[model samples]
Target: MRNVVYMAVLLIVANEIYQKPDMGLGVFMLVFTLSRQLQDITSKLLIGAAQFESDINYMKIFFDLKKLERENIDDTAELIENGDIKFENVNFSYPNSEKLVIKDLNLTIKSGEKIAIVGKNGSGKSTFVNLICGMYEPDSGVVKINDINIHNNLTAVRRSISVVFQDFGHYEATIRENITYMINVGMQVLKNYFN
Candidate 1:
């Protein structure tokens, strides 16, 4: 309200001064000041609009995830103490493609044993890891932990398993985030003993 009164007084004074026969320069100065103020206001609005658009775009990804369908398999297993895992004559292919990504795969890992998989790009390494983690079902044959098929009891199998995937953007995240961002223990990350 105070600013409005001041502006009205200034405009009344300017109007009286503008009526003078030789005040063309005063008119020019008033027009230039108004134009500069308008530009500053418009520029601030434009910046706020841009920031709002960026935030909406980032939030849309999480909204889309909430609408996604979750897999439903109603089976849980006993707690796995031995951690013995085996894949017997497994074969698999992704949806919408006939090409087999994993074919005739077989393997076994006794409890507390360490194993490494190495391959060139497009090899079945990631696919094999996904199968072991119960992310995907084997199209044929069975994946078992202590003779309990993963398809029969994925919830219990996953409870005892921890997997660190290898891919672009897999690293470069904070250590707490690197493990699925499950914790926020300040900035420091746990050391990768292998690295």
Candidate 2:
């Protein structure tokens, strides 16, 4: 496009020069204006191309993330109703880290029992919880619930465990909806009204 514009401007200048030399000044001004516009257009095209490349890269990443998360593993038919949990000789370290976050950790909690893990910051407290939740596997140990290895029935184990974060839900929802969200619709009447 720029080449075509340059050629047209050149022809206009050449025609003006051949017909009337007095018109040379106006022709020079026209060529100057056209060149400036062409430069601006070229810059805009370059910027737009760069922006499109960036957007395409982000789109590829988005699709890749969706592909990674599309797990087809079916949940186990066995339901883990019991709350029993155990971690025996569990050793764990995060990816690409040599430091042992939890080493030789051994603990057991009976069903219907409640216990709190206490430690300062960076004390493997969160790691222990992740291990119990089946979010992470041990390096060379076993995590059990009801004498059933958690790794064996990870889906069932996860179904039996629940974790509540500090920022657990969206803040934009109404107070009534937020409060009653536990049972999204407690009864058929409420479900019909929501529908």
Candidate 3:
């Protein structure tokens, strides 16, 4: 398109020079304005194309996650009476990584037991907590709550377990308000379940 514009401008300049040499200044201004507009349009097109490709990649990831969720779905809602957590030879690694974050880990935390997972940076402390919370499944073995496999039934685990991460969200609300907000959400879920 720029080439076509340049060719047209050249023809116009030639015609102006042949008819009236005094119109050379007007022809130069027209050419300059057209080139600037062309540059602006080309830049906008490039940016839009880049943005479109990024959105497509994002959607692909979104759909892949949705499909994974569907595969792991369990419609039955099992209420957890005891919060006992047991990890039996659980082995796990992050997706696309060969390094095992949690390897052959066997642990048991009976209900009402207080425990702390302490480790240095890059250790699997966070990964272990995620396993307990049913956020990620073990590559081998099982994570169980009250002897029930959490990967097959997550609703029970979600209702009974709550973890506060180091980077927890800080809403601009009072402590009571923040606490009550989660209570209200739970109540709404119960109401919907009964209905």
Candidate 4:
């Protein structure tokens, strides 16, 4: 609307200058051209803003669904009294990838078992952990926690395991916030250290 008003003003000024045969006719033409260019710029900005808003709406919907799934998993985790992990004939391919990363893999970890997973880079080591952490689902087969399917009881499975990734990032927040965020514990532990 503002752009339309500015364009209208520029046209009126250009018409007046032309009718009067004034020396300022060149300046009016320049102003008119500039106004038209500005209108085009504003139109593009509005279109970009609309696209951004649409993207944001999609993200919100995705996050909301994720939150609901997380809540359901947490509820299921609370029911588990023992910890166990199992992967049965699992297969997965990344989005848009032509190759499968894990093909018909099977593994089982008993409650309180200590296990080490070793593989070369891009050998699906991280992919296996990600699957266990509930970050990605198997394209086929099933993962179980304590004999219960991880798909059916994701919360319990996640609660039974802790993982520290090799590619973990350091938070640049205050020391207190960083520790609290990582441990997800109260601030009282830091108070004694800081004191």
Candidate 5:
């Protein structure tokens, strides 16, 4: 639609220029053509500005998430080695919500221990997992991996543990890409261990 309007304007000016090659018609055509081009350029500039702003916002979020993933690597790695985890007087609630999900929860697991958490829907089981994964911080108290405070040494704490959420999604991407991403994460865990 915009292109058609521009073309129509250009055709009208071209017809006038063809009818008379005089100074007045030439001046009019030049001014009209300049005005039309200026409008188109301004419109494009505004759209480009909006798109650039959106791109910057998206990049900011991406970088923030990456930083968090790096911070949690340590605790996750430690958990892999010892298979121990503990929550000490932990309390948690979702952001902007008044209800508490986990309240003063205390739990511990020994190295090489196998444990299962059973609860009905909305019974804070998922929220507890999220707390362990560093997705949400406890309102108070501590989550420890192998007796290390997760908050104090986030990377170290994260390196000690790994989690597979029941609600996790499988990407629509190829199997190779999915497996590669997981392996890359595992390699990162190895690096954390050696360092």
Candidate 6:
């Protein structure tokens, strides 16, 4: 529709130039150049509007989450014992999405187990981690830490799990400083844990 309007305007301009030969080649070039600039600006504005709309959506989600009221976690909530992670018959999808990102998945990672998750984009690796971290709940089945459901006491599970994302932040400090940036524990505690 926009393209058709642009073509019509160009045709009108061409006709006007033809009917008035006194306008000369210079006038035609000016009109053509202005039209090209207008097209470029329109394209950029459209791209920017799309990006702005996406940002607004993200902001709405963020604010809605902020305004949500959550139940207080009981002090007696069970803490992770051995960090043995298990996913049993898990099925999940993002809110408002019909397609399951993780479907009928079952897996186990024992305490101190070392494993890597490698997959192409949109293959659910991050979604899997989010489930384990209690950032998201499975649509069905369970995500367990030490046989206790992760959602039962998310703070405990989160404290026990550590993750280094591919797009982790860079810090202008020593490695130790960077590692401990958000950590509230003392250096001695970190030393003991590492040892």
Count of clashing residue pairs in every prediction: 0, 0, 0, 2, 22, 0
What lDDT score goes with residue 89 in model 6?
99
Q: How would you encode candidate 4's per-residue C-alpha lDDT over 139-164 as one tens digit per residue?
A: 99887876777777665555556678
Specify the poorest-scoring 10-residue window by lDDT in model 6: 185-194
For candidate 3, lDDT tens digit of each residue in 1-195?
767866787677777777998877777677767777877799899998987786676457544643542333344776687778899999999999999999999899999899988989889998899998898989999999878899877866776677787755333468898678657755765454444
Candidate with best TM-score: 1
Ranking by lDDT: 6, 3, 2, 4, 5, 1
- Which residue pairs clash in candidate 1? none
Write one digit per residue (lDDT tens) for candidate 1, span 1-195: 545654675676577667874766676567557756766687789998987786675467545654755555344345576868899999999999899988998889998899888888878899988898788998898899888888777766665566766543223347766555333211112111111
Global lDDT of each model?
0.70, 0.73, 0.77, 0.73, 0.72, 0.78
Cα TM-score per model: 0.57, 0.53, 0.52, 0.52, 0.51, 0.52
Off by over 4 Å in 4: 1-81, 173-177, 184-195
What TM-score number comes out for model 3? Answer: 0.52
Off by over 4 Å in 1: 1-58, 70-78, 167-195
- The lDDT of model 5 is 0.72
Residue-by-residue lDDT tens digits, candidate 2, 1-195? 867777787777777788898776777777878787877899899998987876676457544643544333334436688766888898999999999999988888998897888899889888888888888998878999988888877766655677765444432357777657534422433333223
lDDT of 2: 0.73
Give the Cα error of residue 175 in candidate 1, in Å: 6.1
Tens digit of lDDT per residue, candidate 6, span 31-80? 77888889889999999898777667645754565465554455444446
